[model samples]
Target: MSKKLIAIASTGGHYVQLSRIMKQANFDSNDILYVRTKVNANDTPSFENESLIEDVSRDTLIRSPIIAFQMLKLILKHKPKWIITTGAMPGLISIVIGRLLLRKTMWVDSIANTKQLSASGRIAKKIAHKTLTQWPDLVGENVQYKGRVI
Candidate 1:
């Protein structure tokens, strides 16, 4: 069987960043899967389209549990060798689920977060196999500042 790579991204900027990495990584389409919202899915030809909790802000906290469950299901079903994200809620949850399954998880905090880590990135620091930031100043022991998608 082919090694599977699961790339998760939310709408807008998150999608742009993840898509850029996906394009550069050049993994075969058959070995790649995307966990994204309907808004962006119309453009990327994904292998699966399960409903994950949508992009959320501080006020939309109630959706976290649902997103967690959905991510758990996806991870168990696909068992990807690597799980990557340009992130927010869903990405963080997938990292948690993916890690629980002993899968490698990477998170590239959205370019939007400059001074501080985004909500998901903060949580990712404890769990993800690797966490990347777009801004150099934000680099730390566990968090890294890798070049951005561009």
Candidate 2:
């Protein structure tokens, strides 16, 4: 079957959170395309269908264009119907490109953002098909308080 979902996140906590959700999501392995930030030479993929993008953040604006290009390429190659993230910057970028491709997108704000949504998450609320916060207190009209990854 063609992969229908592009599941993305940055490294560390974001990646861990996304991984946890994917494990419980019960999506067929063949229908999922996982994406994560490329961290190091040891960054071997855990899933059969996975891609890595250079790690970039707001502080690294110069690198964003590169990431955008990468996201576009991946979106074109995978042609996923849905894009989901437990994000930092890369995942957020993926959602933007995926949305431009008319793909459905979901953003799960990191559990670490207990006080507020991450910068990327805040933007995602405006564009993503669904935006979820781990903390119930953070939920509002556009953001939902789904159970957390942690």
Candidate 3:
């Protein structure tokens, strides 16, 4: 059997954090896909081999069916077995779609010093196969602490 396909974050802090995890996980570079909203022309070399998708911002994320449609397309194209994220809106959409498709999904709430759980983390708890928090105390029964991604 082939190794499962994995999707990782694409931009901002989420992308940076996910990149570290992916490196540690030593996931097959070809089997990993990356999704991000902002693409800097100069940063193209960073994601040369992996599949890439633009993340839709929070304000327009769920409000637009296009975002959902795009997500569905990626899910179909990649057929990933695991979807992991760092609490971004587009990443949340991927988690939800992966769940609906019965894929294994992991959502890691961002470790930024915010007292509240992120919108992505909250929604992911309701649907994801696992909700991992960097801070053990903030997690409820539905969420688990998986140590800091950093």
Better by lDDT, candidate 3 or 1: 1
For candidate 2, the lDDT comes to 0.89
Candidate 3 C-alpha lDDT tens digits along 1-150: 222655556477888888777788888787777665547544453554454555566666555466567777877877778888875877787787888888899888888835767876887888888888888678796888868878
Error of 3 at 120 (Å): 1.9
Model 1 over residues 67-148: C-alpha lDDT tens digits?
A: 7787777777777899999887778878888988899999999888988999779999889999999999999979987688
Q: What lDDT does the true structure give each of the candidates?
A: 0.79, 0.89, 0.73
Best by lDDT: 2
Error of 2 at 117 (Å): 0.7
CA lDDT, candidate 1, residue 53: 44
Angstrom error of the Cα, residue 89, model 1: value is: 0.8
Q: Per-residue CA lDDT of candidate 2, range 1-150, in tens?
A: 357998999888888899899899988888888889888967777767988888899899789989999889888887889999999989888888888899999999998898989999999999999999999999987999869778
Estimated TM-score for each candidate: 0.84, 0.94, 0.83
Best candidate, TM-score-wise? 2
What is candidate 3's TM-score against the reference? 0.83
Worst lDDT run of 10 residues, candidate 1, spans 44-53
Cα displacement (angstroms), candidate 1, residue 93, comes to 0.9
